[model samples]
Every structure is written in structure tokens, then in C-alpha cells.
Target: MPKSLIASAEWSLLLSRLRALAPEAFDSQGRVLNLVAREWGNPGHGKPYLSPVDGSQLGLLPMIDLSTATHAVASAAAEAEEWARVDLDTRKARVSACLDLLHENHELLALLLTWEIGKPVPQSRVSVERCISGVKWYVENIESMMEGREPLGLISNIASWNYPMSVLMHAALVQALAGNAVIAKSPTDGGLLSLTLAMAFARRCGLPMSLVSGSGGKLSEALVRDPHIACLSFVGGKVNGRDIAASLYDRKKRYMLEMEGVNAYGIWRFSDWNQLAKQLKKGFEYGKQRCTAYPRFVVERGLVPRFLEMYLPMLTSLKVGHPLLGETRAAEPPSVDFGPLINSGKVEELHAMMSEAEAKGAIPLYKGRLEPNLFLPNQDVSAYLGPCAFLHVPRNCRLYHNEPFGPVDSIVVVDTEEELVTEMNVSNGALVASLACDEPETARRIASELRAFKVGINTTRSRGDREESFGGIGQSWQGCFVGGAYLVQAVTEGPPGERLFGNFPDYTLLPEKR
Candidate 1:
């Protein structure tokens, strides 16, 4: 089939699938356009632009062939306006229904996620579950949050590829439940999933089709610059997020950014050495691809010998295979402990970093590699670079100062929490850091002393939790945070608009209830 034809066909298939899965949206003339795929490249030569988890062609529709992304932004902006105008009770009902609709179509959605994003099937399931859970939380708490019912006006949700559906949907629904107009954008990598969910919303709730647009290129730029999109929520790398922040800086946009973190796990103290060993083994389960994955580990001088005594063996025993085979934490065989970096360039960059680290005297515990000419025409496989080595380096080395985003984790020894804090602050990124101490006092001290935006105590960290605000300080973000009532604040609680009715509610009220 011709590439353009295949692109059109993919859109058709997506619409049909969504219609069947969500009859309500279909009945309401709601259709999702998978815009970003069509914007990125041409497709249908059998060799996909993207690679699947099993080394097969990813077989996705290209982004360029789709309709102009500008149309998507306009449509979504329109929907946001209409959604904002709707009564809070009605909006709540629609959001609540969406949660149910999501649950009812979980399996279908999961499959689509795997095909569209190249995540392993098991991880897809978790994403689906997390999305649903996030929806449930919003539904249950939205009313309590909207005490005044003054709309925040505009909220924008920017999502990433790794867990597109869950993160985007969860954040969007929370904003919607709070009665704000939400302008959302899916990354180039997972636009399919984002657009599909938008179709579901339009069909099920009789929502304006414009509410969720999925265009790429200039369209996304337009959406970001739209004066109406007052509050911004973003999830992606620090550089791009920072750019977004710079754009919105003068406008004073309410923003929430879950930017990239070169996260670390401190093995200074552990409640149970054996348990820590087991957990860290599973730590690389997601191929160490997640922003919250532990890419660096700090071991106390005294604990190093004993910790490694148990930790090394546990890591070695991990099953590096297909993601479908229950290895949710790391890439596995057939799958490896991880998939390739998002693209070849990332692979090269990772290799360069490893090489540089090795040259700098960092010792590799498990060296990672990718074959030179693996993308042959009939290989029936995509790219597979197994997890790289876990390197040990001096506390102040360059390797220790960087956040190895992939399956590479570096080890540094510290004699005190003070030293660990100093070393971690060594890098400019302060997104997140972890503590795995056996003693409560050490964990407490580190938690108090640490300069990171978020800290994980005795466990690998993640960004999905709804109550906790997930953004970093310093170089990690542009002052936007997501979680709790922040979503509501971002959209509805901005600076006063045109002076309409009476004076703003009284600030100096009477005595307290207590």
C-alpha cells in the first residue's frame, strides 16, 4: 500500500475502533484525528518509522499525511470554550462517565497503547489502570476543591510518550472536573493514544469535537501562544519545558511541569538489605526509561561491600526479555531489560556517555550494546540495545554529576548524608532524588537537607500520584506543578479578568470556626 493510503487507512481504523469501543462518541459524531503521527513522517513501506518492543516494525501512520495540525488546535480550543461554559454538575457527570467508559474499554485501550507507543503490553496495562485511578480520584474530590466555582479560565495539558494516555488523560480529566477549559497536546511519539481518548470524550459526553485537538508542528505552537490558554501543564524533557516556560513567563501563565529528572537512589541505609537488593533488581524493570527511574545510586562507605554483596547478584538474575512477559520494571530478553532509546540518536548519545565515563575510570558492572547493522530488511525485529552497565564512579566525577536517563545507573560512595546532598546538588538538575537508608534519622536528615523538588524514601519514585505536586526546583522546570488542587488553580484561579460584577470576595472575614 502507498504510504499516504496507509496513513489514511490507519486513521480510519482508529476511528472505527474508537467508535466500537465508545459507541456514545460515535453516536455523537465525535471522531479523533491521530494528528502527530501524520506530521512526523511517511509510512506504509512495511518498514515502520517506529520500532515495536519485539524488534518488529512499529507500523504506525505518519504525522505529515494528517490534516493540518492548526485545525486540531482550533477544534480543541472551541471544545474548551464550550466545556467551560457548561454547568459544573453537568461537567462532573461527563467526567465521571468518562472514567466508567475508560474502565469498560480498558483492554482495547491497552492494546492500542502498545501498538501506538511501542511500550510492552504489561506496562500498557499499568498505564490503563493508572489512568482510570487518576480519573476516579478527580471525580471523588473535584467538588470539595471547587468551593468558590470561579473558573481558572484556561488550563493546558502537555503530555509525554512513555505513558501518554494515563498522564494526559488523568491530568486533563482533573482539570475538566474542576470546570476549566483545558487545551491539551500529546507528544510526537504518542499522539495516537491522546487523540483516540479525545474522540471518546466527544462521543460519550456530547462534548464539542474541538475540545481535544491532536495536530503537530505550527498547530502546537499556535495552541501554546493562544492567549486563552492561561494555565500550562507539561511533561517532557527539561529543555523544551523550559522553552515553554520562557514563552509563558511574561504572560504569567499558571503552569505545572513534570520535567525530566536524572533521579538517583541512595543505598546509604536500608530497612532490610535483602529487600533493598530485590527491589533495586526490579528497579531497572522499565528499561530504566522512565523519568523517575533510579539512574544513580549513592552507597555509604561502610554499606558498599555488604550492599553489593547482595545487590549485584540480584541484578544479574533479572529476566531481560519481552515486556509482555511480566517484566514491568525493566526490559527483559526477547525484550531485554529495556528497549532501545527513543531513537538511534539517543542510542549514540548514550553510548558516547558510557564511553566517556569508562575513559574517566568508571567501572562498568553490566556493559550495554547494540549491533551495528541490525535494521536489515527482513530481520523481523526493531532495535534492541540491552541494559547498559551499572558503573561505579568517584563521588565528584562527571559521571556522578549527570543524570543517566536510560538503564545506566552510576554508584557513588558517601560517608555522610551531608556529602550525598552536596554531590547530588553537584548537577544543575534538581528534579528528584531518592533515599534508601535503613535508619529513620538518616532518611529524615537527608529529606530535610536535600535540594530536590521531590524525594523518594526507600523506594523508586514515580510522577503518577495525584495528591503530590510533581515538579522540580532550579533547572528542572519553569515553576509549573501538577497534582492536588493545582490543576484547578492552574485553570480557574488566575489573575482577575475584566471587572464584571461586585468587588472580589471579602478578605478580612470574621472569627474562626474553631
Candidate 2:
């Protein structure tokens, strides 16, 4: 058989299995996309999910309209106090059973997640596994977090497309574990099927975790302003975050807003370029779509050559193609380094950002080309851009301030010590920042100077696990946090404070409940 034919066969087989993960998305005869899932299921609206690699319609999802979404929120709010009254031990047991269901269907969910989001296979699998593990950690350790707290009605989690399961949905599950009724808005671009399946599993296990899906503009007002919604969690770009924050300003609501920032890594008087290079290579695992992705690099004037020499090759060598394609296919296919953006429109946006930066002074280190796709060879590879990186991005450039949420960003070379910190902190607030300094005293100094949520010295950090807290400082974050106890507190009612979690720098100083 030809390679394309083989790939087609594999694609069909895998897609069938993926569809099995969420039977709600299909009809008995496989015609309707009836996908509104709550206590009772109904068909709302059909939206076709386009493939990121080729712009092909992967499947049509039955999404909820505004009325459906409002009802879901109202229902969750009305039932939350009763849910809180349930014995904590019983709640844990129910959630544990749901996690077991998630575990059993892990491979199924992971397969669909990559197809929906354009993440590589290995990376998507790890995301699903880690989501399960992280939620388990919260469930086991949440008793201490509820000390002086009460369940804060309904927590509406609305986040970006990239980390629907691992971050946004992870926080939603933890909210339920913290005794709040949870409702999550599925990312309209991707992850609809996987999230709906996970929520369906939770609902089946007796958890009041409802899910709604639609465009943000249509539902943002309803979800944010709904009287029943006690807290709102918005995670996406800065514009959306700001709009939601503004809406909740006068309202007595618990909220967490995590927006984008220039997550920069500074190189100042560092010797180990090779080690730094490897870490940088691994850092762009998911096309830099992650909230914690270090898309900007601030290198010392003297170290620019060494940094580029070590970093450029890794950036340019990234492979972009269909997630199902590989040299050999077996139990687990050989993973590609880079995959599709959410869709073709995003690819065009990335091009525009690169063009703007280039016109302003940035140099294109690489212009990525798409590889031949065996999986969907006939379809145009519009969403797949191989590996594109830029250097000499001016401080005033839009690319410097706005994060290009794809596999592209720029490097800025700075001369003076003050200039290094100045350029790194130019975004004012960022999710994460790191400085590469082998020397201890200088590393500590540089790390302290960073105005980011998480700072790393000679290493890279991320939205960490159970013990570590995750929140942005300054403009990057605006509300309470997620991760361990902080996440629990954010969803539950409590007194105002400068510190909620352990002394984590990126902790969002939540506003007082009026």
C-alpha cells in the first residue's frame, strides 16, 4: 500500500477510537452532533472543528447557545450549596471514581486532544496523564485548604485553547474538589470533545461539573455577569482577560484572570551555552502555545553570538506536519517536534507579527517550511509552519510586548546590566522569567530583579505541580491563584490578604470582596 493510503487507514482507525471517547458528539446513525451535556443531553448548535495542519473539518461539535449556557450556570449555582453540604469524604470518593474513569480512558482522551489542538502525540499524552495526577494531588491534599473557607457557589473557568485539559480544566476539577460547583467553558477553537468527555465522566461519577461551549463574545457576558456564578476564572490573551476583569470590577465575585506576557529568558555572563541550549530546545515543546512558554530571549551583547549559535539550530530544526505522520508506525509513532497552530488564521496572524517585527528592526533567524504530509496529503498544509524564529526584536516592536502564541518569537541583545533587566522587565508583568548565570551571587541578583511570577536561575520553570503555586504578577495575573492550597482558596470564600499561598512571587493580589 502507498504511504498516504496507510496513513488514511491509521487516521480512520484512530478517529473512530477518538469518537468513542465522547459518544455525546455523535448520533445513533452518526449524523447529528448533539453535544449539550448536563443532567440531560440535548443538541444545541453544530460547529465544525477545523484541523490545524490542513484546515480540514475534523468533526462537527454540538455546541451550546447562550440560553443553554445561562441555564447551565444557573443550575450549577442553585445546586452548589447542596453539593458543599455533602460530606467531604464522600466528595473525595466520587472524584476519585471519576479519576479512575479518566485513567481508564486516558489513551482515548490523549489521542483526541492532539487532533483537536495540534499538539504532538507524546506531549498530548503527558498532558492528559499529568492532569489526572495533578487533580489527584489536589483531592488528597484539599482538606487543609478548606480551614476557614466556604464553597463560593459556581466557579466558571474560561481559558484558552492550548491547555484546556492540563491547566484550565485541571483548575475546574480542583474547584469541585474544593466543594464548589464547577462549570467550564470549552475552548471554542479546540479541545471541545475531550473536555466534554471528561466532564461527562465527572458528571457520571456524581460530580456537578457542567460544561458549555461557544464563542467567547456570545457567552462571556452571560458567564461573567450571571448572578449564580460566584467566581470566574479567565485564562487567555490580555484583551479578553482585561474585559472580563473590568466586568467583575464592582461585583462581589471571586475571580482569577491569567493573561499573556513576554515570558523572557535572559542570558547575562553565562558560560554553559550548551546546557542552556538544550533546555531552550525542550522548552518550546508545544509550539510555544503554553502560558508559561518563554517566547522572548534577552541576551547580553557579548553573548549574542554564542546564544544564537546554540539556539538557532534547535529552533530551525523543528518539524511541523500532521500529528499522525511518522517514519514508522507502531504502538507509539515517532513524535514530530512541532505541529499545527490552532488553525490557518493563527498562522496568518503569526506571519503578520513576524512581518511587523521585521519591519521595525527584528531579523528573521529562520523561515519555516511545511513538510510533506502523508496523513492528509491532498489537503493544503495551511496551518503548519515548520520553525520560525527572529532576533534583534526592537524594544518598541509589538512582537516584544505582545506574545506570539505560536512557534515564533524574537531575541533581543542588550549591552549594559541595567539594560538586560530593563528589557526583561519591559512587559511590566509576566507569567515567568529566567536568567542564565552560573555564578550564585549574580544568579540570585538577576532572579530577584525580574518582575515575573516565576523566576529561574540557570533553568526553566513552568506552572508547577501540587506543592508549587502558579499565578502571574502585575498585568499578567489579576485575582487569586491556582495550584495546591492557593487554588482552593481562590474558589472558596475567605478574608482578603496580601498573601494567600506561601511566598510565591507571582501570586495575584486578589481584590477585596465588597
Best by TM-score: 2
- TM-score of every prediction relative to native: 0.78, 0.91
Q: How close to the true structure is residue 129 of candidate 1, measured as C-alpha lDDT? A: 90
Error of 1 at 477 (Å): 2.8
Q: After superposition, how far is residue 416 of candidate 1 from its true place, in Å?
A: 4.0
Error of 2 at 318 (Å): 2.5
Collision count for each candidate, in order: 43, 0
Number of the predicted model whose lDDT against the real structure is largest: 2
Query: In candidate 2, what are the lDDT values of residues 134-161, reduced to their tens digit?
Result: 9998788878877778888788888888
Q: Could you give the C-alpha RMSD of every candidate to the true structure, in order shown?
A: 8.0, 4.1
Candidate 2 similarity to native, TM-score: 0.91
